[model samples]
Target: MKKNLLMLFTLFIALFTITSVKADDKPVKNNYRIASDSLFAPFEFQNSEKKYVGIDVDLLNAIAKTEKFNISMDFVGFQTAVDQTQAGHADGMIAGMSITDERKNVFDFSDPYFTANATIAVKKGTKNITSYKSLKDKTVGVKNGTASQEFITKNKDKYGYKVKVFDAADTMYASLGTGSIDAFMDDEPVVKYAILQGQKFETPIKPEKIGEYGFAVKKGTNPELISMFNAGLAKIKANGKYDKIVAKYMGNEASDDKKVDESTMIGIIKNNWEQLASGLGYTIALTLISFVLALIVGIIFGLFSVSPSKFLRGFTKVYVDLVRGVPLMVLAIFIFYGIPNLIESITGHTSPLNDFAAGVIALTLNASAYIAEIVRGGVNSVPTGQMEASRSLGVSYVKTMQRVILPQAVKITIPSLVNQFIISLKDTTIISAIGLIELLQTGKIIVARNFQSFKVYGLIAIIYLIVILALTIFARRLERNMK
Candidate 1:
């Protein structure tokens, strides 16, 4: 009787275990992934407490809570977030993205949550730049791809001003302060936030035509996600959560002041140490890897250019000329965004090049051309007698070039090579075009959050100077050792 009773209990336990396992294996119903800008103040920017707390952040969280769905937020930059959403890597985006007809073709958007307008601002105490009429014969700045750019481009002819498009707000503001640009246009809230944070700028023009901000997803991919977002947003608004979020970040500003003051440069650096350090690491890694690749390519092509065969020399010439002719910025954009599309068109395969890898490859290609010329000059600078002596010593042509000529050429070109590396390091700033944030981009992110462009840029300039100086010192030591 005891044995029979134990067997029954074991059977019941097995059934229960099977039922629990099946329940656990059920798929998650409505998990959505979203992307937002890393810094776009009051809409989305990191606070002094190091938390990503702002209007967008709070609103998204509230929406997810009301909808009973899990959300994962990826705080990549604006361009990257758009790229990922279009590629279907993220379910949606809500980075204070302005809704426009052009964007609607590629992305489906939720209901408009906010509206904003572009405004013209200039440094204080500037002369005769009060209105659009005064902007004639002046150079104005606008952020790339923004409505401000469109506004400036459309009206530039009428205003008789040249427009310069910048990638980031901080850079644009810096240009205004330094007189590189006479005036600039950006969103009213952004400019107001900058002023509130002590940026020495004044908005002389009223807000321009208004645009609605919306959450977006890739077109025709996730209708359910959009529905959920819209439903939750409506619910949150009805329940007063939306109003609270807006007022929390946008109102009672003096009570919740956290902008960095003039004396807090050190504090800003200390507060954002992790971001800066990560950026430095990426910059160093990019520099070292790209330099190494450039060195190898330069040496090979340098040899080819100096080869006895006419065909080999011609090949090297065409390559060097073509690569050198194209601008680095253009080449980088092509490699990062265009290559995948080109590949897909030709082969019907969607292989997007890794952003960092594309950057390194572009840098390597550009630097290699210049380095090839340096290497050739270095080799030619060597006496012809050296190669003759090596050949007379029964050394093969290949061996003589490698064992006798190349080493001397490399040593002679060491200073130039180091300089080229430094140039390459600085050129990494342009790679931010394709969304790889190195040191400069990192500083831009911090400045966008804190609105302390002068201090942040000053600190970035120091960091860059220190790094290049260290490289210069090392090069000098190397030259001395060689001597």
Candidate 2:
């Protein structure tokens, strides 16, 4: 237990030292890491060639070219873009974000780049909902962290409607199609784009101007970036480039050519093989790294739980209980967003932890607690007589534990550990909330592009099933070998 604690302490210190060293390396000037929404069409979504090219993407690139500033855009989802920008992992963001007064507390905004309204959309041929009062008792959907969500939530009680929030626009649109939601509110352009793409939806109520969209950076950081964006935006609008860019995406002729026949399952698979393969790779890699770390930390804590010292056992108990009590999604968000904000508040410097590191740490913390209990149960299953016999032979307690106890405990725990690994792998889906593009998130991205929810999600499910079955077979074979 002491050695384990020492090793854990050393690991943390090493991480901190590395972070400090990197902090001293100055960031390149005028070269910014910009974050944008992955699935927000017209603003930002993939083209037919699988290249990211939307109004926001093209506009930002034009702005960068005009300003002579280098920029790299990360097409994570909207909520993730916000989180990344706030955490300083991204230098700025331009995700059709509304310039709400509330946001002014955290982000400094550029001049309004575009104007749009939020409208209530219902399925075609549904004549009932003409106003807010007409939506009484009906469920309405909104994407998370959007102006539409804020409006829906704030007026939900007054309108006597229930609200369902989705993580992405594609899912919310699907819900409306399936009647899971009677209606939904979203940006006018996005709803129109969906209609253009063959979605059977209509806007009944007059659209409300939610707010103008603006480019933003964390408050008090990168003032020059905002200045440059504003200056370049003015130039583009003056030179007629802004109107042309918007027309390219939203014009009457704007439509993606079908790269493949996505109607059939085989076609869907053929079209999306690269994305599916990449997502699966990320999922497997995250699972492998997290499980290994969890195994080490869990065994340490498990040993601590069984230690003779009351303090050690009590500390382990508290840790296991606390971590186990929190939900995985909540833990992930806290680790990714809350921790960085907390660090910045205290030390006045941004924490360098990105989504991947935060996700691994969250998964490791959650899995280790359950694994500690598994270890404790396995150790307790061994007979007390073995330890007594070893001690009677003049063996030290630590040596006896090393030579007799742990080996037997490991054998007993092997099955449970294998099961835990499988659970951890599935749990990686929850990490998508933190914006780590694991298997499920990858599916969401593809669905955002093709709107083939059934085929894409079905393919993802099959992939997961195959991987889990393989792992299960391997585990069974290992158990047979051990026997």
Candidate 3:
């Protein structure tokens, strides 16, 4: 009996020791907030489904999983992401940052998980230089303020290349395609993606080692987090998962000189745009819905602005003063991001607001303030004789305005309404801040894919110019008809 008791006590102690050891080895949950810009595709972007799904995002998730931590992401702008980390809004930035001395002073860096190779992409069926040494007097495009830009400028005498710098890689690539520039330099993946996609005019050759890309932790961030992330990255690389994800997006053979066709690319894009044309239904739908709401709100306040009663007059003035005083950007941010969060806290229901709803609400709220002024002007423009004539006929005050004053106001309001409607249409772009995909959003999506600000967004600007011009013509015709 004594021997059996000793054996049982040993078994229990051993089991408890093993369990404690396993628990201690497991990582703690992350529970950290993060932010990044919505560019850097195949790495970090808000996809069509509005989810942040990309290679960088995936790697970050893997790290969090390995480190036993949780992180929620804020899809802010890239410049904003950098600022946020510097200002301590986020703990770190994992947005395909390269460790440069200029950036290194303010931010600490993890080990380079990846290095971006440099390449010169040029138009199709063109071979000017047989060797790197043969290159001289070539006009090249490099992204502004990048190392490559500096390289091109500094070595202009050495390489004999005249460099044209642009704010975006996409525009730089597009210029290469259009022959606006002879050669372009950019990160390997971005250049390759453009080549594969239809900017086929340019192809990367010689795939030279350019710069190192790493994750950035803010200056003075927790060193333990950096160590854990570095370990997690190593594990992924060793396990073959890292290579798979890279191959899936960037292609298996980096050196394979794939040529893209012009016709096929255009056709594929046209087909996609045909589908995207249906997306305009949502755009128009929101515009019309919001226009009506704004019109109603405007007319109510407009009447109150011109009200005979002092209480009603003062109330309208206060409302006008408040909404007009607040910036549209601030209001949209508050309505879309702030209001929902407030509601969630109070009700304990994380009510998800649809992007369209938030955008429409913002547009309406903004337009109504302007519309009220337009309406008040229209109402005041009506002859006092007209109101008196209706009143003399024993009609009520409401009836006098509806039957006599408003009819005349309609003719004058027509021009103002058209202008107001145009303003509302354009202002919907601001809702992109809260994740709404309007026309500007569509342009940004294209810009992200192609990195061509000129060809991509410039084309969008042309489309807008044509659209607004057509609306102006229509408005003028309507005014003439009314006159």
Best candidate (score: TM-score): 2
How well is each residue in 1-483 modelled by candidate 3, as lDDT tens digits? 999999999999999998875555444444666766566666675443335666788888888788777788765555546655665556677766667888889988888888877677777777785444445777888875456666567768887767788855555656766778887777777666555545565453576666787778677665555766788899999998888778756774432212222133453255336433543455667678999999999889989887778998899888788888887778876775567657856886545456578777888888888888888899999988888888888999988887788888889899889999888877766666655556666666555644445554555566667777988999999899888
Candidate 1 vs candidate 3: which has greater TM-score?
Answer: 1
Superposed Cα deviation of residue 401, candidate 1 (Å): 1.9
Clashes per candidate (backbone, < 3 Å): 0, 0, 8
lDDT of 2 by residue, 1-483 (tens): 999999999999999988865443333485799999999987898865678888999999999898778999998889889988988989999999999999999999999999979999999999899999999999999988889899899998998999998978988988888889999999998888777776789999999888899999999898878877888899999999999999987887667736567767898787778887888898998999999999999999999998899999999999999999999999999998898889888999887577889889999999999999999998899999999999999999899889999999988898999999999999999999877888999888777777888888998899999999999999999888877
Q: For each candidate, what TM-score against the reference?
A: 0.82, 0.90, 0.61
- Candidate 1: residue 162 lDDT (0-100): 92
Q: Best by lDDT, which number?
A: 2
List candidate 2 stretches off by more than 4 Å.
1-30
Ranking by lDDT: 2, 1, 3
lDDT of 3 at 271: 30
What value does the lDDT take at residue 371 in candidate 2? 93
Candidate 1 per-residue C-alpha lDDT over 198-281 given as tens digits, one digit per residue, 9 for 90 to 100: 679898777796588898988976676677678888998898989888877666471233654434787877788788888888
